[model samples]
Every structure is written in structure tokens, then in C-alpha cells.
Target chain A: MKQQYGIKDIAKMLNISVSTVSRALRDAYDVNPETRKKVLELTEKLNFKPNKNAAALASGSTKNIGVVIPFITNYYFSTVISGIQEEAYKQGYNIILFVTNDDLDREKTLLRNIATTSLDGLLISISSNSDTQDHFEQLMEEGVPMVFFDRVPHHIHVSKIMQSDFDGAFMATSHLIDNGYKKIAHIAGPKELNFTQERMNGYLAALENANLPRNDDYIIFSGFSQANGYTDTVTLLSLPEKPDAIFAVNDRKAVGSIQALKANHVQVGLEFGVIGFTNDPIATVIEPNLTTVEEPAFEIGKQSCSLLIKHIKNKNHEPHDILLPGKLVIRQSVKLSQDS
Target chain B: MKQQYGIKDIAKMLNISVSTVSRALRDAYDVNPETRKKVLELTEKLNFKPNKNAAALASGSTKNIGVVIPFITNYYFSTVISGIQEEAYKQGYNIILFVTNDDLDREKTLLRNIATTSLDGLLISISSNSDTQDHFEQLMEEGVPMVFFDRVPHHIHVSKIMQSDFDGAFMATSHLIDNGYKKIAHIAGPKELNFTQERMNGYLAALENANLPRNDDYIIFSGFSQANGYTDTVTLLSLPEKPDAIFAVNDRKAVGSIQALKANHVQVGLEFGVIGFTNDPIATVIEPNLTTVEEPAFEIGKQSCSLLIKHIKNKNHEPHDILLPGKLVIRQSVKLSQDS
Candidate 1:
């Protein structure tokens, strides 16, 4: 029969503790460099291949964080994942990715079927449905630390990191108004999303402060897609009272709006103004370049993962909500008003 | 141990083999609907978890496939992931993602640290470095069901899925030549990449077929990035004899080339011509809409994942190589020659 060896065996051989060997194995920053070097040399000499799962089971420290997202095909989500990956790599941790495809049923089954025993913690941006909140709550009850980013549940008392959606919307609307555009409309995301409602409130607040009449017909709720933005803009254009400017929930929708305007032979920057949130790369590619407020997608991802790791390390850590601000990026989309 | 109830108990209740019960639990397609329903009902009643690692150890099936990619922030890679995710979902498999950030050292460490015991198979797009092929060959020798995709390793007899790079490049270069651009320079990806060399060959072949002088100075090899395209274009434009057209390796680079041309007051699609491979969405957004050869990114992803799953199911399965064709998508970047 063959005998098995592990970090503990190496620790005993080196007159060290198992925790020291584990930290050295994970390449943790706190470990002394000389001790780490010694551990590595010994492990290499012994040809030790650590069984990640076995080590995780024994110590309840997996050095892995599970990230559950809705979609990765989009610019924002993928960029966010890049940020998360960067931070995870720097911290000597690995992330496992799960996609829900934005279906609540799949979201539910995925959560329910998750091997929580294997995961040290979780980071999730859910399907954005209130009904699925219970599944998240169940995960929390299991003592698995978690942090929600971007699309988060409203009433959960957990760590969360998000971009400043309302402030960015306010900035976009004010920029359009400042550019001498009066008849303004907004293309919003699905109404149920927390950010959607917050952004809508900011837009409305900006309009009310400027004493502009609010027309119910000016607000359109649709999916966060370019096609939705295009269709919504078309609907707005066909109205008897055409808007002079449009504030979009996202850049993709804004791109769609610009395309619809171009297809109709409408001069975009010279006449109709468009301001979008989330300065996607396509913002620069579109003609008359899109004016946008850049969402802190990467920062949000980094902060969320960083926060989740803190919670995992200390169970009693207090939950906090983080709202990173967004900044307006000036471009060619909005017309230059002659007067300030 | 309380006579530990598990999948075996469920199998006994349904008068089925344990493998059938496991298949039903995994939501495999061939399982009977009635049998699956019964199995689900019994499992639900028992509150069974079937601890993933334990079940995998018992049956030698983890039902998880690991995917190792370089970057997901780009359009092609993200779209490929979408295809992989769709196919994985349909086939009742979960994908574990690992990104190497295009670093050879990181790639080596990641591949070495992979928990092979917990994974059913592997899907990899190598970092396009010859040095890392040894790590892959070691995995293959260990009998790990694996498939290489897109950025494949050379000198390895393994199942692989990639777009027809040489054919696509030929189409791109020939289209430029046919449009009356005699001095066409190509800004290509890193020299070590398989696709980069293949694309370069196609460009050389097109020039040879047209009886145009092939200048060694016409080819510039650099990183796969927009910045690379911009800098390379700047160098070409500054040359004593500037090329009349530019064919870039990818759409982002094509967009960069167009931007550089337009910045220098060189009218694109009129005075100068540009063409690209990989008709990314940015192709439409870029001014003068890039003419390109669209790679079958999504198809390659789906085929690779599907092939890996077949290998996982049967270790002795024959390995195959697939090369899906790319099609030319004409928009406005290429100039219309008057004589032709």
C-alpha cells in the first residue's frame, strides 16, 4: 500500500506549524520570505502535489471565491470579470465563474444545486428578480460569506459594491440640459432593477429642478440592449412632440439611438443630443462619438471581491454598502450650446 | 455513520442502476422522463446533496469541465464564451473558467495547479508559446480528457477547433488586391501565434498571385491590441513610401488603423483602403464601417466544448481537428477601383 504525504508532513519535517506551511503554499503576503522559500524548496524536493479539495475540506480555507454573474458577452460584465480576476490573482486566490443567462428559474436551480460545502464564499450579481432573493438569503444562512455587486437585492444586509447609478444619471441629464436641450427623454432599463429606478429618480429630479414639464410618454423601459435602445428611440421620434435630447441607461442603447437617428437622416450632434451611462468601448467607435458617464465596473468588481475576502477571513465582519462614483466623459454626441 | 443514505438509496427506490440514478441527477439527455421525475421527487424528499467531490470519487464522474482561456475582455473571446456557455448549459455541464492573462509563467503555474482529480475534462486555448506545450503534453499523458481550441499548441496530435485562419487571411488580402491596392501592409499579432503565421502566409500568397512585389518591410508583428495597430500604422504612414492600404489581423486593429488614417486627413474608403479579420461588432461602429472576414468564433467554441465532452464520456474516443471557414463581409472600408 502507498502512503500519502501533505503540508502537515512538510511542516513537521521543518519544525514549523501547519498554518505556516499552508500560508507558504498559498504564497500569502504575511508569510516570511525566507520561511516561504524554505517551504517551497522542501515541497519541490518532495514532489508534493497538494489536493486542493482535500486541503480545503481539512482547513475550511479554500483560497477560492465563487463568482455568479448573469452574462459575460457584454463589455461591462467581461471588464468587471477582468478586474475581479486581477485582484484575485494578486491576492493568491482563484475564482470559479457561473453564469445564469438572466433566467430566474436557472438562477434558482443553480443556487439550489450549488455545492456550498465546497465554496468558502460567493460573489453574485443575480437575475435581478425579487423572487430570487430568497435563494441568496438561504446561502447567507448557511454561513457562507457573500458580496453582491452591480445588480443587488434591495433589503439584504450583506456587503455590496456598486457604481453610483443615480449620480451618473443626474449628471447625464444635467449635461443634456446644460447643452440647451429642452425636450428631453430617457431610455431606461427594466423597471424592476434597483439601479433603473434610482437612475430614473435622478433624471426626474434634474428635470424638476430645471422646471421642465415631465411627460410620461418620454420615459421608456426596456431591456439593456442596443436593439431596445434603437426601438425605444424610434418610438420617441415618432411621437408628435419629438424630444431634442435622449438620456440612455447604457452606452449600447445610446449606440442604438444614434443609429436610429442616422438611419432617419437626423444630424446627431448638431441637433439631437444623446448622453449615455457606462462608457463602453463602442462609445468611441460610433460616429459623432457618444457622450457618456463611465460606470466604475472594474472598480466595483475589485471592491466586491476584496470585500468578500474580508468577510470570509472574519465571519463577524460587518456588512457595508459601497457606492463608487461615476464620471461624465465629454465627447461629440451633445451639441455645444452657444450660451452657458 | 447512520447508514449514510445517498444516490444508491435513490437508485434502489426507483429500481434503477446507480449510474442511471447519477445520470438522472446530472440531467443527462438520454435518461427517461418518467424515471427522471421519480428520481427528482425521491431526491427532493430525502434532501440529498450528493456531495460533488464524494459522488465524483465514487463514480469517477465530476460532471464539470474546466476551460482555460487567455483573455475574455475582447469581443471574440467573450462571444466564444457565450457559445461555450450555451452549449454547456444544454448538455448539463458546468464550466470552470481559468484566465491566464496571456502570461507564460502564469499559464505554467495555472496548468500545474489544476485539480485534475475534480475535473472531468479540460478545454484550453494555449497562450501561443512553444515553451508551454510540455505542460499540455504532460496532462495528455496523464489521460486527462482534453481538447485545444483556437490558439492551439503545435506538434501535438490532439482534438482542436479553430477558424480557417489562412483562408480568411487570403480572402482579406485578395479583397484588398482586387480593389486595386498594390502596396498593402499587414499589421499582425505576435509572431509566435499559429494564426499570426498562417495569416501572414495568406497575405504573402495573395501578393504572389497578384505578381505584386512582396516587401519584407510591409509586415509588422506585434501584440494583439489597438495600440499596436495605431503605432504600427503611424510607422507605416511615416515611411518614405507609404502603403496605399492596410490589412489588420483583427477588427480592433483595423479600427485603430482607420482612426490613424482619418487623424492624418487620409480619407478612408476613398483615398486609402483597409480590411480586417474577425468582424467584431466594433466593425459597424467604426466610421466607414470596416470591411472584414468574419471568423466563426462562436462555432469554434461550441465545437471545442462539444468535442471535449465526447472525450470525457469515452476516454478511447478518436481525436479530431475542425476548421470552420470564415466569410467576407463587405461594408465600406475597401475603395472601389474605377478601372475594375
Candidate 2:
């Protein structure tokens, strides 16, 4: 490897003092314009990048924000990351990405070893299996400025940004009931996730308001995958009395439900209705384009990052929560009757 | 904000030298057992962290890798990142993410400001419109090891990892030909991307092998999006000599093509066939179940990151290219004919 040139070497080469070189590099007024220009030219020519560690140590700012996400393979998470990246870029901050793969153990290890010294702040979405909040509490105790987004812990007293999951679920379920589907089933995500619980409650509330029986057997707890949704739908279809309509936690699961229905020779949009949350791009591709709740994933990311920067700059700032509402997008998936 | 504690403060608390404190934190044998235990206890209690900048200055290793990508709001890229994250975590390295959004200016600016001082290595995928190699040359000259993956620049002298795009395209085209499709149109990505050219070459080769004419008008250049695919397919259908089959660059575009066919009241699987590259999860959601080529995206990410780390460790190591083969996944999108 070639020898790296530091500011000291540049000072020596220019026959200038070390402090003068540092000041000139920092654009301090103590250095002459000619000397500053010489240092800049030489550094640019040599591609001499000052060690970020040393600069961060001296300035007490690393210009790096850590983003910890549960998963990245889904559309919502990926779009959120894009939004975060845009905000971070405009603010001259780089993002350090850490994915827990929705594993509790990995999340614990990741948070434990996170180099807080090299980060200005942290943006996190808790894992589904993170039943205990010890890891987050520890980081908070250490005074690491962090903002949670999307799948956040309910008990955490930090700034949080998320879509109105409850409202979205209510709207989806109500839309089905209004379309003359009294028997509705819900394919939900892991029960441990807070959003899943909220969505379930919303489903129950909608059924209650419609004067329909709340059948526990109509709900299925599974993973956030198409396979899970397909299996759950198959199980529901096997029941003595099956649901007239199905509401999925996400679009992927809804797609799987539709596939399951088609495989069983059931007519979608006519006989068995289906609705999905998170209006992913796949919604349009599916036959009888799925009706869904449009989640503001990108906006959540942009707002979370923007808020985190504010917290990073002002330590005394009070933490708050921001909940963006989801919009109902009616498509061909659910059929509407002439009567209310 | 509370006063951030460092190794110096921990050493003072434990009544030890800064070097001994650092060595103890690093689990070095030179430190006494009792003193090391005391240092660890104090540091843990105070949440004191070693200055990454200072440590990098003393030892050239930062234990950080930079990942430069074109886009993230897609299944392929996001899944690739998941693979990269898995490997990076196992290797005990942190990943810094930079997104170019497939824009040439963003790519250039990102490369220009990339701080080599804080990163041990870099893993990159060049943007489609990136025509300049000067920024990459600058990084290479600075002795910062980097490895390119997927959409890489042709002129760079670095370890590059990518899937066998040509073979995938050839197989897709050949499958269409075998299914009695004489006139096939291709929806290609941007013309500047090397992968696009390679895919086009494969498409042309498959036609020549089948003794079919390669129509220049059959190929359309556009961005990698479902909307682009839809518009391109519409344009192709408007021609006097319409194609019997359409091979899209990706599954998103393939879905778009299918939608266009459906809108035009054309029988997709029976009359007009559609095959796609990158067997994205959406393939199953689309009606007729898209037949496509599955690229080894995860393997590409893992191999690219591993190679980058090796280069970072051994500066004199020769750069090599890795091209993993893709497989054809048969589904219901194309019609099957019994020949044997």
C-alpha cells in the first residue's frame, strides 16, 4: 500500500506549522489566502482525505446517521430507505445501514455493538420478535439520540413516526362490510408486533359497529409472507363456514390469498372479495387489481430523518410522535352491491 | 445532551494509562487482568467508547465498508442488500449505504465526496448514465480498495461481480422462439448500462441461432420501471408488424406488458407470450404466472462484499471478475408445446 499523506506531512512539505495547516484546512481566518490555496490545491491533487475519525473526534460530530431496519426486501421498507437517503443526502449526512432480519437476537447484538461514537443519531424500526426493550433502554440511557419509525415499540419514550395502522385497518374492514360482505376474515402478521395488535383491534371495532359476530376463528396469526397468507387462506377455506371476504395485513399476503382462491377455482372480485393494506406496486399487477390502504412509507422516512436531525442538533428538544394517515384506494378486488 | 465519555475519561476513572485502557478494551494480553477488569467495568458503566477517528489514525483499519448502489426501491436491489448485510455482519464490518437513484450527477457527486479515510473498502454498482471514470480512478489512485457489482462500468480496473445477464437473456429469447414465437420484441433498460447491451446482444444471438431476423425496431430503451414497460409495450403493439412475444428486461416491465396485453383484449399466454428477467416475487402475483430468469442477486452481493474485504486486507491482490449463472424458471406465462 502507498503511504497516506496527512496534514502534518503537508505542513512539513510547505514549511508551515502544524496548527497553521490545520487552521487553513478548516478555513480559519488566521491563515493567509495564498497558504490556504496552496494547501487546498495540494490536498486535491493528492486526494488527501483527512482521517474522518480524527476530524470527528476533534469536532464531536461524525456526520453519520445509523438506520436500523427490521427487513429491507419489502417494498415499504425499501421505499422508506429511499426517502431517508434523500433527506440524509440533502443534509450532507451519510447513512449506516443495519438490518436485524427481524430476529430478536440479531437486533440485540446489533444495538449492543453499534458504535455510538461514530454516529450523530440513530433511526430505528424495532424487530417483530423484540419482546424486551432492554437493548433500546440501554442506548437511551447512554444518551444516543434516536428516533423510531414504522414498527416502533409502544412503551419507548422517544420520537416515533408511523402510519395510522388502526385507521387503515378499520377502513379496509368497513369497506368490505359496506360492500355486503358480512363474514370477513383477516390474515394478520405476527401477534407480537404492535401494529398487528392495533390492526386486529381495528378489525374487531369495525365488526362490532356493523353488528356482526366477532369470530376468533376468522383471524389467523402468521408471518408477513405470501406463503403464510396462502396457507392461512387455505385453512380458512377448509372451515365448515368460510369467510365471504378476506383482509390481509399487507399486499404480499393479499396476493397469496388471491392466488389461493384462484387455485381453488373460486372467483375473486365476484364471489370471494379481498382487500390489502399497503398499496404496493404488485397490487396493480394482480388480476382484479387489489383494493388497499396507501401507506405513506416514503413520507414517514423523510419526516423521521428530518426530525432526527433536529434532535441531533438540539439535545434538549422534547420527543414527540407523528402518525401519518393512510388513504383508502378502491380498486376491482372488492365488489360493491347496489344497497348499503 | 450529557457529556460524552471517551477512553481517556474511563482510564482516568480506573487510574490507568490511555494505552492500557485501549489495549484492555481491545482484549490485548499486555494488560494486567485486574487492571483490565477494572477498566472494562468503568468503561461499561460510563458507556465510554473508543474514538473511531483516533483509532483509525493509529491503525489504518476502520472496519467500515461503503456500498454505492443505483436504486433501492426494488425487490432485486433490496434483496441484494440483505445478502450484503448478512455477510458484512458475520465479518464484523459496518456498511455505509449511498444511493444514486440511477442519476449520473448523483453518482458523480457521491463518488467525489466519499471519505476513504473512514472506510476500509467500498462495494459499488455504477449508475446507468455514468459515462465518466475519473471519480473511480481518483479512488483507486488513493489506495482505497473497491469492488463493483451488477451495473458496473466497463473501463474500471477492479474486481466486478454480476449475474450472467447474456445467458439469461438468451434463454428467455430461446424459450420464446421454441414456443413458436417468430417475432419477439424486447423492452431493454437504458442504453448506457453495460448489462442492457449484454442482454441485447444475447437477444440478438438467440434470433440469429434460430435463423430469425433481428429487427432494430423491436428493441426499445427505457428506465427499469413497470410504467416504462407498459408504455414500451404499447409502442410495440402500435407498429404495423406486431410481435408475437415480448421479453422484458425485468419482472416489473413484464407485468406492465401483461397489463397492456390485457387492456388490448389480447390473449397473453396463448396468442402473445411474455417472459421477464429477474424472477421477482411479483412474478407469482401477476396472472398467468410470469416465466422468467432468476438472477443470483443475493450471491452477487455476498461475493462482491467478500471480494472487497479481501482486497482491503491485501492491497497487492489481483482484481478478478465473477459472473454467476442465472436459471430459467418456467411458469404459465408461456404456452407449452409437446414435441417429443
Against the true structure, whose lDDT is highest?
2
Residue ranges of candidate 1 with Cα displaced over 4 Å:
A1-4, A12-15, A41-46, A128-132, A338-340, B1-5, B13-16, B128-132, B336-340
Q: Which candidate is the best by DockQ?
A: 2
Task: Mark the regions of model 2 whose C-alpha exceeds 4 Å error after superposition.
Answer: A1-50, B1-50
lDDT of each: 0.86, 0.88
The superposed Cα distance between candidate 2 and the true structure at residue A50, in angstroms, equals: 4.7
For candidate 1, lDDT tens digit of each residue in A1-340?
1126777899999999998997787777899999998998887677566776666655667666788899998899999999898888778777877788888888877776776655678999978554548888877876889999999998989998888888889999999999899999999998999989999998999998899989989999999989999999999999999999999999999999999999998999889999999999999989899999999888988889888889988999999999999999999999878885
For residue A29, model 2's alpha carbon misses the true position, in angstroms, by: 23
- The docking category that best describes candidate 2 is medium
Model 2 interface RMSD over true interface Cα atoms: 3.1
lDDT string, candidate 2, A1-340, tens digits: 3538887899899999988877665555667999988987887777676666777888888889999998999999999999999999877789999999899988876786677878999999999988999889988987889999989997989999999989999999999999999999999999999999989988989999999999888999999898998999999999999999999999989999999999999899899899999999889888889999999999999999999999999998899898999999999899978885
